[model samples]
Target chain A: MYGGGYIHDDQKKKPEMQAEDPVLLAEFEARIARGEKIEPRDWMPADYRRQLIRMIEQHAHSEIIGALPEGTWITRAPGFRRKLALMAKVQDEVGHAQLLYSAAETLGKSREDMINDLINGKSKYSNVFNYPAKTWADVAVIGFLIDAAAIVNQVANSKGSYGPYCRALERICYEESFHLKQGHSVFVYLATGTPTQRAMVQDALNRWWQPIMHFFGPSDKMSQHTETLMRWKVKMASNDDMRQQFLSMYVPKIWEIGLTLPDPNLKKNPETNQWEFTEPDWNEFYEVIKGNGPCNAERLAVRRASEERGAWVRAALKRADQHYVTPLA
Target chain B: MNIQSLDPRITRLGIDAEEKNPDQTLQREEHWETYQVFHQKKRGEKHSSVGVVHAPNAEMALLFAKEQYARRGETVNLWIVNTRDVLAMNYDDYDVFSTTPEKMYRDPAGYKVNDKIAAYKKAQLDV
Candidate 1:
């Protein structure tokens, strides 16, 4: 559910696409045009398969890593009910990772490789997690605003042409409804509470605003590559459009609570009906992706340590007759 | 340096901040094999294919299945099968069933004898 919708391919030099059988490529495009879901075993173009594996794999990794930030708040949640709800939310995030991993697995990468890539930081997740959730109110900002942004991305992706990814998103979007509601509950409680509580929530919003603005990545440069991806149904909505959608839907809700976003220039343009705001620093975003962000090292370190710690249990359960087979949808 | 965090649990884990896990790549089948999960939402409903989960054995597969598929829904039952055991038809062979729908001979609605009976009564009345 935390997939940011914008896929970051090292596009400094776009790889020349492999020449697929023209007839097969045509048929594949035709099927997509007909609104048919492309199943795992179907003949897809090489670029289509590659883009999908990357997109879905990155999405899956986001779900897993996305849990860590929220998981930080579980033990410290204010009440018993809040603790239980946070526990369930964290569990749901992990489960979402599993669903997404299987969806990517249908494209032929093994689960181990995906995990390896994630822990090694070869793959990128949603960049927002690189920041620390410093307080209880930070968790509220994340749960409400961050989850809301992810829902915008995920709901659009559920309509995508890949069958398994679409199916996974369908289930994920269902569960994310609860996450958004719980987040709103926490946010509202803080925003409408004592002056100290409102200040805490407002401070959290100030810190998260930039990261949330950077969530969908930089406005996508309209290139032939992006067009091809869109035509293939690999990339559904443009990053800018999805960002606009998120701002339109949630900005009002945030304003209604009398909470101000950190950006003074953030306002809907009554003339064009598009929300305009000062552009977030794209340089910082790229730097964070390069592993210089505040919490990136800790996040990967913890993940690697968990893998190391769990090795014994997995080794114990290793069966002599076990064999790996690609999952069928 | 040890990792520092707002969450005390992570801080207390005392992990070396710069620890490089050089040999942490999971071996093939290290996570075990996949099982295709079938979920029945309610009693008397047919079990439908939900998704796949990896586990060491059938029991573990079922456990993971419940966690993955039945977490939020009203799942009355679940079935897990080894992915290798499933013999599936290729998309290439989808044409095998393509002409089947066009036949219409297999459909109960295809047998429209009422039209012929009505035609016979009309002819009798004309005579």
Candidate 2:
């Protein structure tokens, strides 16, 4: 999955990258303008490398942390089919983490450092995952809606200018399509089931609606650095555009399934061909990202506990002949 | 899920019951062998390297690879090769990969066919 679509301005320490040659920078920009992908070995502006490392590292962190909520439901899934499907689905999320981490690693950060930053709360992930998946139906909502939103972002980013990231997203988007089907099937099953089941799903949808709205993030007009990011293809679609796309595509589908959205202002504008909705509570979004959300502490604690528990596994995998070498900055 | 362990000497849990058994050390899932995955999209297509999966055996490797690499109807066949078994030439010997002579003629572009074909078509049309 993708991050919450935030390009954070405040990383604790920004690398003091030296100025790139203006001619080289111009050439690089022209290459991007010409739609040429920048490979790992290519010379780049320091800001580009710094921005991509943050963006892709956050994406990778989101995938693994994103796995936790759904991963918890793997065993408790209602039946054999669901259990197996969820297992594969959650496993795919972890695999996406591996793919994304490798892609980010090509930018020069080790997966270990990324994880360390994640564990220490020095980096960020999608804010949606900080919320709890309280029930089985929450799984259905998250799997379907969250995965759908991610596909929207990923499909756009797959065409981005970074070669390894684009290649990885190509594969990731392919897998996510199948994940969408599984998620949609589960959502349909729960939605069309008995009255109790229907209510269960509806409640889950209500709980998740705000988070889903917050998923694309606060409107792009609120973002300041987006213009340059867009030029570089690092931020492919603006937050508003992606939100509009998701609403246009999925709002009708949700209604067709006999589910109602919690939003009173949600409607499509005929003249503008845009979705008009109540602005999501950006205050709550900020609160969640600042470690004040209902599940943020718990999520990070669980991650810390998991790393401690899994230390032996990683240790056992280390070769006896090799010493640990830290990755380049 | 209640299946027995495949090893005859081990208990159903796949652990030796004897306290002194050397195999009773830390049992971590990381010990699983790495398998390189190659996927063929169609019957006649060439198999291409997709990625890798870690599994205890070949069967498990194939099973893991299906959902990991082939879940989206992306492949008709998959090959899982244990990573340890792969032999490789060092990059220091990268010189061996190229021949000293240029092979420009290997490409049809070498034949300078565009001018010839255009002139021939032009001549035919003129006639």
DockQ of predictions, in order shown: 0.86, 0.08
Q: What local lDDT does model 2 show for residue A180?
A: 85
Chain A TM-score for model 1, please? 0.99
Candidate 2, A227-261: lDDT as tens digits: 77788889899888898999998999899988999
Question: Candidate 1 at residue A77, lDDT?
Answer: 94
Query: CAPRI verdict on model 2?
Result: incorrect
Candidate 1 Cα outliers beyond 4 Å, as residue runs: B124-127
Shift of residue B14 alpha carbon in model 2, Å: 24
Best by TM-score: 1
| Worst ten in a row by lDDT for model 1 chain A | A5-14
- Give all candidates' CA lDDT scores: 0.92, 0.76
